[model samples]
Target: MVAPMGIRLSPLGAAVFCLLAVGVIYHLYAGVISNRYAAFRGRTSVDLRDLLAVSVEAAVLGGKEVKAVRDENHLEEKSKGKTREGASEPLTKGDLQSHVKMYNLLKSSFPGVTVNSEEHDNLEDEVTWSRQIPDDILAKVEGGKLVPANRVTVWIDPLDATQEYTENLLKYVTTMVCVAVDGKPMIGVIHQPFTGFTAWGFVGQGSNMQRRSSYSTNPPNVIVSRSHPGQVESYVRSAFGNGTTVILAGGAGYKVLSLLDMPSSTSGDMDKGDAYIHITFIKKWDICAGAALLNAIGGEMTTLRGGRIDYSASPLNTGGLVASIGVDHRALVDRLPEWDPERH
Candidate 1:
């Protein structure tokens, strides 16, 4: 004979179930509600940059194999086989792995904010201008033009040093993001994953966690990429003369960080001080974050010909750039050759 019994939940069981439900609700609130910073949109972008840096660093440390992917257009459609113009090669999977993480995180954090990340740009109208505007950026009015922070674009580079990261040169790897309004950068965030350091700033807000010393060296030590040397050696030799010292490093973000006097073990070394020069047409994601930081320290990042960067234009920086902490930036720029070797 089979005995039929009614299912019953004991008081202890009910209490446990209730606690579990409460825990789940609390976690959801923490992720969605508590993290909802609709008003401080600029700060939100900076925070997300830090989150991506931490996430990517954790993935690397956890022994997860990072597959490399290269998409010249820097679009989010690597999986869909779509890329922006001038993309000649296939996307690398490892780079896409980090890029996807950053894209999703930003998209989730600032629901309708316009994101113009290197990994994704052609977002639907469903995902634009849904977040609050930062007051500092909103208050900015230049040459009779009111800054439209509400309709700004957020540029992100989830992982900057793809090749260096693959080669285990972790120090050079960084996560970078910047907010631009009407083609002008208003805020920037740069995070070095391996070093666990982040630098962020908004125009007129001074700096976000960056320490700088008022020091300059004669002959000026220049920072150049170890991966892409280009015509840097000859240019420095001719422009600054043979007395100029060149420091070889990987990643554009890292090179700019050094220019900002970012706190590092080697920061105390006065030898590698002064400028960061790139002769090749670089992607905007690689320069925007660093440009914001440099601007915060009373520094300037301009084309070698002393021209301004227009973010609203194409993603490529055609004129090349020279970033310097010194006020004598014009003198520095005058030293460089007129044409970019990669371009001309």
Candidate 2:
């Protein structure tokens, strides 16, 4: 073979080659190479703590939309249908607006994760919200771990108490977000629009709120839905005693707040609720955030049958629910009558 001739590139050619090489390296690092490294190391691409922080912000954004709608007197309401108990299921402009805001924020922040929202309507253009976690909140969740994007499901109830909102029961209104990993709720954020209060928790981590001192009241004061109190009052009385106090409330989020001793904005005092009971069909989005918060604080929330509610399953939770803090959960379950789907 003949001796090879030497080749040289011009300055422009050299510069172009360097730029193209850098672009290729960046693409590999941003996608294929990084993904393979993560898989090999069994590490998740998304941090659970960051996701939780973003979710808290998303809830606050949704709540702002809700409050704006009502405060501006631009509330518009319609009934989707009647509930199983023949109660009107209300949908409002605030609900849809809040849903859009929350959904867009989550989707934009974590494009790979799955987000489930109660309202199906996509009414407005997508909005961009900050993914940056505040320094204080980030410090609190510093030790939090990571989870695979596919394994995490974000459940959102942009407007938890639409019926109450329509009736001007603003104290019961809340925007909630729950991050469930492998069907177990791991993080929760609840924001009260009118009160400008926000509470958040991460399982195995700390929370922004503390368990109430009166959480273990004997013959516990049971909280039930004022809108759909289907035999829950009687069930609570039967399980504990005829003298057991039943506190009727509007929203599932509000009931959980009461149990946590979060002062009611309207009353300016802690709402009296030791346990929350529900015998009718409830949506996962309505209760998932509360369940996660309870779990974070060493509390328990389960089916009246003492079964774990799986968020990966159907959105509807047909089984009865009972949640309490600083109480014997199993004993409470053992005392309650078996929850029959056909019968209450």
Poorest stretch of ten by lDDT in candidate 1: 62-71
> Against the unseen true structure, what C-alpha lDDT does each candidate score?
0.62, 0.85
Query: TM-score per candidate, in order?
Result: 0.65, 0.85
| Cα-lDDT of candidate 2 | 0.85
Model 2 CA deviation exceeding 4 Å by range: 1-44, 263-270
Pairs that collide in candidate 2 are none
Report model 1's TM-score to 2 decimal places: 0.65
Instruction: Summarize candidate 2's per-residue lDDT along 78-165 as a digit string, tens digits.
Output: 8889988788999998999999989988888887778999999866556775667866567677744867787888999999988899
Cα distance off (Å), candidate 2, residue 56? 0.9
What does candidate 1's lDDT look like per residue over 34-55, in tens digits?
4465556534322333322332
